[model samples]
Target: MFKFNETSPRKCWLIGHRGAMGHAPENTLASFICGQKLGADMLECDIHLSKDKKCVVMHDESVERTTNGHGQIRNLTSSKIKKLDAGSWYSKKYVGERALLLEELLDWIKEQKSCLGRALGLAIEIKNEPIRYLDIEKVAIEIVKKKKMESRIIFISFDHGVVKRAKSLEPNIPTGILYREPLADPFKRAKELGADAIFPRRHLITKSLVQNAHKHKLFVVAWTVNEVKEMKKIFTIGTDAIATNFPDRLNRVLSNAVKR
Candidate 1:
């Protein structure tokens, strides 16, 4: 259901995880902007709805790690969340950065995609559970639909239940299954969830696993691959994309190697 841009190369796509997190504060607008400038094909981010049902961009359940504020993101209003300095804790240069609403991020992506003449997409990881939040799937889907980005948005979640719920809400929207451990059959799990993609840790992507996942018509994307040697292994394993913090390194590697 998730179609990549026609202009994208056949080789592994390089997505900037948490918006080139290695270069800037993770999950902040500054980081996302910098990643886009640094040649990221897709910007990977986590999304959670605020108390007022506004989609907010963040990585952690708690704000204390990345922002000046402390508490659950859902408990805070847009105005209250905006007031916290999200970047200063990471570096002084990023001191004034604040949490970006999903709408704001989508606006920035629209402008960037137009300016760059490329198909920029969002790999949104849903961080809420229905048990924890009343209607996370409904709110998340509403925002993406409102932005008209359902075509470009890939909904991913570590929680399989959430992924299933998303698919139920909008069967047309593409979804991905995120995993940290080696499942007995990742392919089966993905198929069960109706996922278009299977996102797993770098070490878990074996050659056989890739082949099996692709056989099921699931795009396989390995996460946080930053080293060149490791990158090569993933390529050998045949992933559809590699989520990395160093897009520049991946670009340089590709530039050096000319396919025979």
Candidate 2:
């Protein structure tokens, strides 16, 4: 897995927020590939169980937002979800793109690694909010284990319990706590949750939060920062990673920052 180097600001990974949502539809294979082509070091996506208990990629429990289909993800089987056009809502060029199963993505990543001689990281966000997927952590982690891609993954979730469940199931895979509200001693709480990192909403990030997290040997990744100015500001705060929809833009900013 590509990790951050404290001495090199440019090594702070660009985690593609929903697979470079600014360029392609969120959470589809097309989006993930676009992120990689645009210079993202890690592809971040959300996962939920299908009616048949297969792990599928999509950010919501419902497919309506990013798909040309209707119904809750858990109510639909994997085969049914696979037929849904997951990219048309974003652009006509991506009309035929379908939602992919987790295994399919893992296989693609493996292929990419062989072809490029480098591992591309994946941050699978466990979508256990508002509704829970039964045994999602075990199922997802089991799939990663089957593919032997544990080292390249970092599981994250707003529901800290779900993230904790991931740790209990697969101690080898690193986990992170996702929070919208600022926590008291963010690094300490993340460690309490058995997480190796903390993912804070961009507004919740402060210099002290990054400093304290680094002090505890925990890393901070700020999320959904799109504007160039905001990206530069977050970069200046010493975060280990920045999750963004416009990874291409973030790449340009980081490149310029490096030159200076």
Candidate 3:
């Protein structure tokens, strides 16, 4: 449902990595709000299933890194996870910010889009590795459809099975594959997984790689690009999208690039 702008000079998307993680706590509402205010074309967030089977916004399988709590997210219920202080670790000024439910985040996005008079895209990365959540793909798809947000979001995963499963469940939904290593033929692999896009780590992207992906009709979105120089390099390489921890910085880069 998320379409790339063909007419733009760069023909690249500026996505907020973990909702402007450089400005606010990752995966929190504050960070997402900051990204939206900074004019991010899209917001990228990670998802995990709680012990109670609710979809929760978190990048890690455990809360140790991002929150004041310690434990596997799958071991905790939504109520317990919501009670933890998700922002203090990043800054005391954001002392009371809590992790958001996927539904809550979607609602916030919807509200922001209405007020901003523009559509905001979302990249939802499902965290499934080592230990897979039962039916997470199905549940997440159901939630997105219920929110009527199927058109505004795309599913991405490091797991090929997850990407394939998501596409199988909903043929119309767009899916992307996330990989860090150099693949022999990324386009072929992505096509095998039924992915419309491929998200490679910044270092793995090359001009030939982008060209090949584009040749196969697959969008190439580089992940977690933060520095100005690195952003410029990726832009010059012609990636279809740049995912960054600082959406404001990416916006400035895009603006300057367009002017030049």
Error (Å) of candidate 2 at residue 74 is 0.8
Give each model a TM-score: 0.92, 0.95, 0.95
Residue-level lDDT of model 2, residues 1-260, one tens digit each, is: 66532343474678888888999999888888888888887889889999999988998899999888899998999999999999889989999999999999888876553112357889999888788888899999999999999988899999999988899888878999999886767777888878988999999888988898888888789998999999999999888899999989999988888888
For model 2, the superposed segments whose C-alpha errors exceed 4 Å read 4-9, 113-117
lDDT, each prediction: 0.80, 0.86, 0.87
Clashes of each: 0, 0, 0
List model 3 lDDT by residue over 1-260, tens digit each: 24742434435678888998999999999999898888687899999999999999999999999999999989999999999999999999889899998988999887665112458878999989866898898999998899998878899999889999999998777899999888888899999998999999999999999888888998889998999999999999889889999888888888888777
Predicted structure 3: lDDT:
0.87
Q: How good is model 1 by TM-score? A: 0.92
| Model 2 clashing residue pairs (backbone) | none
Off by over 4 Å in 1: 1-10, 114-117, 129-131, 258-260
**Which ranges of candidate 3 are over 4 A from the true structure?**
1-10, 114-117
